[model samples]
Target: MKQYLQSGIVGFSLTVVALLMPVNGIAQSIGSDKNTLPDIGVVASEALTVDKEMLIGDAIMRQMRGQAPIIDDPILSEYIQDLGNRLVLQAENTKFPFEFFVINNSAMNAFAFYGGHVGVHSGIITSADSESELASVLAHEVTHVTQRHLARRALSQQRSSPLQIASMLGSILLAAANPEAGMAALQTSSAISQQMTIDYTRSNEQEADRIGIDILYNAGFDPRAAATFFGKMAEEYRLRSRPPERLLTHPLTEKRIADARSRMARYPEVRLPPSLTFHLAKARLLARYQFDPDYALEHYMAVNEQGNYLVKEAARYGLAIALLANDKAAQAQEINNELLKRDPNNLFYIDLATDILIALNQPQTAVEMLEKEIFNKPRNSVVVLNLANTYLTMKQYSKTIELLRDYLLVKPHDQLAYSLLSEAYKSEKSYKGMHQSKAELLALYGAYPNAIDELQHAYNYTGDDHLEKQRIRARIQQLRDAEEKLRNF
Candidate 1:
């Protein structure tokens, strides 16, 4: 339970879902500036419930990652999914599925996207001094999600927008396209709805702290870990001879950590589960996929001094990932085998084994492994995408279309997913599929830069529009012209 945090709220995408308060005096907080449910209230909280929160969160996730997440690596994806699901089940509302992840960034922070999307910086994994310490962070974010703090914050601010959810969904992509611009926009938009950003009162902080401990204890995890992580951050502050700036949001200090310890003093420590080992194992893997392996190797060994099997697995995965990235396939393969021996049923190991086979010029074997992965992860878009890529490699265009079409059913709004689906359709002479897919693409991404370009693309490929298309097209040209004039000035 040791840690360090940066001044800025580490964001996964430019748009972070946050809850703001109507208090101008507290327009900002540490590790908070993201658009959270707390920042954007449910507008209709009289009937708000956990199920509804999950639905909204899922919708936000779909908008942020699209239906089929772009997971180039299956081993890494499945592992993180499993790890996230484990903690999600332990939170207050098990009905709400929480998806945890290591975003591909080097920022030293972690944050939760409203809905079940909890993200940690690739750097956080490498920085964790102990595996349980990481669990403490996940528990804190889970508290945010299960508590519906985002919606609460929104209601408090009295923020209202006609577009509501659509604007919220668009916020993520805005972050993706330009994080700074999106963050600025978020700040401005929030100010209109609330005061700006509300630094939670000490009472609010204490409540989150209490609930966070309850979550940790109930999840069968050590409550003390929460205190330890904060303690570590406090220590970091002393090391620098200055209080960590993130303290503005998190309010960290030995006093806060001691306070947290007192809150959990009555609770007995629970052994973290076997699943957490898998979580740390995968966190280590994903961190490598997201960061520099050399740095990862040094970090892994340091964090896993406990030599717990799972933490060691994390280091091993980190080491293999580095070797593979450096073109040392032979060495990577050896590590894969070692991992397989430890966890033969592990989805990640199975997938990694296949990746190694594919890299070693064993196409036929790779196909078999990928086909199995697809069958196992039937609902996962990235799994299907990988299988589709494998088909493309084998020159099976029809098979590619079949796989991509299935993927589009789950994630039609993703530009890359749609583009690939369009290519597959075009290759198979499925003109109807190709035309419909293109129009869908234009509608989503067309709203960016200039709407006219997207409208024109839709008009050319938008086969049959019965309503809304022409009206939308007209509005697009007008907006495009307006945008151009604004740019000229």
Candidate 2:
């Protein structure tokens, strides 16, 4: 129901590699043979036979984590979870467990993985901003899972074996068993698995859209919200000057919009709650993604009461980010100062202050500010990272290592944190610590494509005598080859 995103690095890379992975002759022909695509009955039959779709869902979660961290908020998650469950109550399959998660990316996208796995982006949450507007998107994604679109596609890979099934089940166990090993394997293997998902067809998307419209009506949400969202995306595309059809989409074309409009006219529609989040989310996105910093800033400045403080801060941050992108340092600094005055202790504000200082050549002030934040929140991992980066800017290599050591205590599994930590250790001439940290980082985040620049510094410090260096190097090579193969997709 939602469009796939990150077509360049994340999506394309795996697609490129998967295309090269040899498929059986029958498998190759089946994809081309639309006639051979399984019917709904057949798909349902297969789905029933493999009741452990839960395992597949778990694997998908693991693979997702390997690539990036999803934004997790307990209260918001609970809100979404309740909404999803409420909708599912009337559906045929009451036994299936459904999960909805928010991926923390700025890109405006959402998707359903095979099984009942569904994800919305933080951007979508910010974009929808309203219970009803958000519900419309959920209605669409839920339809994908409810209709078994992915399982039908699985049947397309006709002649899939038991081993494949075993691997699917084993995937989550592997991730749980050795998260680092599994994550590394995923970075090495994810492209191959997801390649099939993208080029795949979906007769089900149309079916889901049709069904979702009805669901929206029944749930007391405006059916028009669906078309409204599609129109919103189209408007975004035009305003941003994105090439026509740059994103392959369905249910958003002019005909689709017209069809929705006609359908809306036919239905005895109920009024929707005047949702407040759509414009705010849109404005925030503009601040983050648009090329014109000044315009984005003006847009937010004009609409002071449209959204919450978080939304306002986010908008301001995005505006400042846009200014920095355009190399407007002085203006950006002014904006940061304004924000800092408003939110004196906000972490993001502090981070932006650091950026402004860096741009202004006030490295010592940056160091002082970063140090204060780090000291005030010793257990906070994200803040410590900001401090470490500031240390790197100040060339206080030893201090960088010390702060990284503190951060690792709370966030051992964060690969970037560990990678940065290893760099700090190396800078301090602590070769043993560097060696240990690099191996762990590689094990967790994958060693491919310049695994860690800090690891090299660590090696320089230790005089390259570390025994684990070769293993890390070999893994890095595998990651690089895999990454290269994925580029074509």
lDDT of 2 by residue, 1-489 (tens): 000111111211110000000011111211222234333544454633334444445444444545543433322344566677665553444345677665544445666554465666555665554556677777766666665654555556655542353244334223423456545554554433643353324454445555566666666677777778767767777777552221343325676667666656544667754432343334434554433666755655554446544456556666676676567768878877897897777655666677777778886887777677767777664466666776776778878777777677766655556666677766776776776687656544334334445445445555555566675456446646644543431
* Candidate 1: stretches off by over 4 Å: 1-81, 88-101, 113-117, 129-131, 162-180, 183-196, 241-246, 273-290, 293-310, 373-377, 380-383, 407-489
Best by TM-score: 1
- What's the TM for model 1? 0.68
Provide the RMSD of all predictions against the true structure, rounded to 1 decimal. Answer: 9.1, 12.0
lDDT of 2: 0.53
lDDT of 2 at 417: 62
Q: Using Cα atoms with residue i matched to residue i, what is each candidate's TM-score against the true structure?
A: 0.68, 0.51
